[model samples]
Target: MNKIKNIHILILLIFLISIGQMSQTIYVPSIFNIAKELKVNMEEVQKLMSGYLLCYGISQLIYGPISDKVGRKPVILVGMMIFILSTFLILFANSLELMIILFSIQGLGTGVGGVMARTLPRDIFLNYENLKKANGFLNMGILVSPLIAPLIGGIISNLFEWRMCFVFLLIIGILISTTIFIFLPETCTKKQIKNSIFGYKILIYKKKFNYYLLILTSGLSGIVVFESNSGVLLSEMGFSNIEVSILFILPIPSIFFGSWYIGFSKKSFNYLMWKSVILCLLSGFFMWLPGWFKIMKIWTILIPASLFFFSAGMLFPLATTGAMIPCKGSAGTAGALLGGIQNIGSSFIAFISTFLPKNGQFSIGMITFIIGVIIFLCWWKLSRLEKI
Candidate 1:
């Protein structure tokens, strides 16, 4: 592909990558309203997020081998079709249970598109540094969803009904699906698809790359745990829908900057992960201290949370790329497992988080500490064993 064509495809890939997060976050500001409308608890409403994530994680495992068997473009289109159907169907859901089921299906729809997005730069870019740079750009594109989704969801929900948010998502799904059909080429052409079970086993059970997989999963879980709770917590603190939405957008600029820095610097993934470990510890301390002291100010959450998100800026792309390093012939399978592993940890934590004390302030702090330590130790062990 020519340079301009590559840029267009890259943008589309970013759009695909952003779809799952958009599906989740776009509806977030309206969760409280949905609960009130259904006469349900906010905690029950929060299950929608957990449901989407659980489906999102598990679905990736399926898409990887199938994409390897069929092709990236076909798998992506099928997934997006599922997303479009599920998202549009969400409008007819009359109860919370029905909505939860539909949303999980929508999450399943995002898996193929999202996993393929990760494999693109891995497919096209040869050098590790070049791959990291591409992923940074991809991460920067993802930051746009957080920046834009809440703002749009807030305004729509404030002006109309909470379900209106799905209308917006439905449109996005259609557009993305169309774009992929028209433009995306297959990246996993050379790899023959084995049995789905074999695909996952080869990608995930490998000793060499398992360390990166664990860090990727754990780090993502911590991030989601905090995010899953933030909507309710902000509402508890007396913020309105619009206010909560705006607050959620705050961390993107920092994350974007971090990704841009990594791309510009051309730093290795190992280098960036090592540097971020300290930032993770610092974020954990500040994050934990506020809740431990019962400090309820927004900044107590916002400041530390922003710091940790910025660390994610550094952390995610590196770990994702590292996880794929050993699986050159099976990018789809590896990407799927990596993404699936990511959501498994995150969704489980998010589900578990909902059951914690309503004052999840302290719980988030504890999460930060534990997640930070585990990621750092994983990196240390990977470095020692792999000697990369």
Candidate 2:
């Protein structure tokens, strides 16, 4: 019965995490439609993503420490309510400014789930192997959002309107909130610390934690750079919203395969980490090569990008588990720092991509290559340190 109950908890946690992530990319296919309807430019529409990501990251900082003091369930419930309300209000937003504000608020609410989703696994699963399996399943499940969100958003926007995307999100928010209130239990059993900064200070001083954090951050930022730019780049290539959305699905399977492979294989984490680093470097080089030669076809982008995603699939679960293991005493704060900083890093990358030359293929490829280099250097540093 306890095992069955744990399975239920894992499923619910996956759902909670998915809703937060789906909110980020669900409107991607609707970017052009949103710009057309709102009388804004592409850059302005892109700000909506950056704005949401910024708040998503910032809100985690608050939710993490508070959830440590309070229980996970209440903090998550409050955040879901905020998300649902904001998503509903977004339907009525007629201007870009208002839309941005509401979307950011939506991100703020989802940030609760972000911190809790990761923290709960640590709280409930005491065994390192169990935690690793939980994280593997969690990440594989979360990857589904990116796979389908754009397709669903495109179909919805193509049939109805861009605002309908929020209608869908609002519904998801309500459902997730209901499940949390009914099903999720208080997983944080540790005595609450009076000063939240105590956790932060300890984690910040740990060399392994810092290195793992950078490895996670740089890898995720590369993906964000691709996601932030891909919609516009594909749209400009004369693909319809539906077609572009279909194309977005291409790289996801690689992620699934990578995650599954890592779970079943008996390879050492250090071996997998090195293999992922090599894949990332090669992925970056391929992503850049096609653009450098003036080839800008969709395949040119998708093929190499798929390789990058595959590398991420291998890297993310390992890095996340590595970063959190030592900080188990402060799981909530550690989760907040991990999720918050990565999102912020992605946001910064996305924001910077906006200023790059509009030759979408070249700019995106170059940025990805740079990100690959960053990951390599971080991994090199991490390899020299004591293994986690």
Number of the top TM-score candidate: 2
- In the range 28-68, model 2's lDDT, one tens digit per residue, is 88888899889998767988888888899889988988888
**Model 1: per-residue lDDT, tens digit, 230-340?**
888988988999999999778778788777777787555567778877678788888888777777678888888888878877777777777766666677778888888
Best by lDDT: 2
User: Counting only residues 3 or more apart in sequence or on different chains, how many pairs clash (N, Cα, C under 3 Å) in candidate 2?
Assistant: 0
Candidate lDDT (C-alpha), each: 0.79, 0.84
Off by over 4 Å in 2: 190-195
Clashes of each: 0, 0
lDDT of 2: 0.84
